[model samples]
Target: NLKIILGHMGEGLPYSMWRIDNRNAWVKTEPNYPAKKRIADYFHSNFWLTTSGNFRTQTLVDAMLEIGSDRILFSADWPFENVDHAAEWFDTASISENDRIKIGRTNAARLFKLEA
Candidate 1:
């Protein structure tokens, strides 16, 4: 029903995923799922991420973004960053509008796939 492109994964919240997944102590109680599952199950080829906010290069954020923009959306991180900041980096981000559409909201419509 939906899709996106993953670029610069490990660009966000992925390393943390490893931490959560590897937590033997936590796994003992919540054996059904891992802290990262809420985020990782979303992974798909169509899922995409832009290098926009690689500023922090948070593996968790990047990995999560790679999992899908549905979880990660493009933000200029304004005040702390800028619109052009995201735009400039995104220009060469190496993903497509099929994925871009999601970041731009076209994919949102399809997810919500609204008629309006």
Candidate 2:
């Protein structure tokens, strides 16, 4: 469990979660095949996505909408960007207070199982 948190998620696949859920990719190879749930289904509440370099508000909203408020995280990627900018953007983003709490703190705490 700790390894998953410290491990690297690989390159260029940050958005890979969305591609797997495309309608065209899920056709059954044979008849009577069961329809699979969207990638968002696998985005469990215990997992929180990093803000990383993605500072777009619409995309953030999409992620929140798809994965639920409880699975979003606030990140700055350190030297790549300033912490204040991330904090400000998230602080003023057009979303509900409940969602903000989820993305800004609750999600990270839950994902890392941090005690506070």
Candidate 3:
């Protein structure tokens, strides 16, 4: 199956992941949507998310905790946003340096199989 990449660091999906997991079952009776796994499972296995313009540290941290650092991608949200701002926030975000590197560049490079 093709990988599904999510932008805006999941566009608040990390928060919703649990909510869906909790509520998906409740909604199952209302809607006919069927899934064999928890919502977070799909998040962990099928999706990759980008920081893009949503550069909030707490949300980044929450996403990392909820999904994983390996799935997080970085972007400047160019045209609509400023690269310098993205850079500054990323540089100062409370997460570890390794996590920063992984999200900022390595993850996307690996996801796209880019050559150094």
Candidate 1 residue 89 Cα shift, in angstroms, is 1.6
Candidate lDDT scores, in order, read 0.51, 0.61, 0.85
Q: Please, what are the lDDT tens digits per residue for candidate 1 over residues 5-97?
A: 444443444545555445654655656654443444554433455444453434423544446555445555465567786676655555565
What TM-score, over all chains together, does every model reach? 0.49, 0.66, 0.86
Instruction: For model 2, give the 10-residue run with minimal summed lDDT.
Output: 1-10
Ranking by lDDT: 3, 2, 1
Scored against the true structure, residue 88 in model 3 reaches a CA lDDT of 94
lDDT string for model 2 (28-111, tens) is 654354645444354442245666666778877766665566656777767787888878888998899988887778867766
Error of 2 at 6 (Å): 12
Which rank order by TM-score, best down to worst?
A: 3, 2, 1
Model 2 TM-score relative to the real fold: 0.66
Better of 1 and 2 by lDDT: 2
> Highest lDDT among the candidates is held by which one?
3
What C-alpha root-mean-square deviation, in Å, does candidate 2 show against the real structure?
Answer: 5.2
User: In model 2, which residue pairs have backbone atoms overlapping below 3 Å?
Assistant: none
Report the lDDT tens digits of candidate 3 across residue range 1-116: 45988888787777887787788767646655586778788778989988888989988988898889999988888988899999999999999989988998888888999957
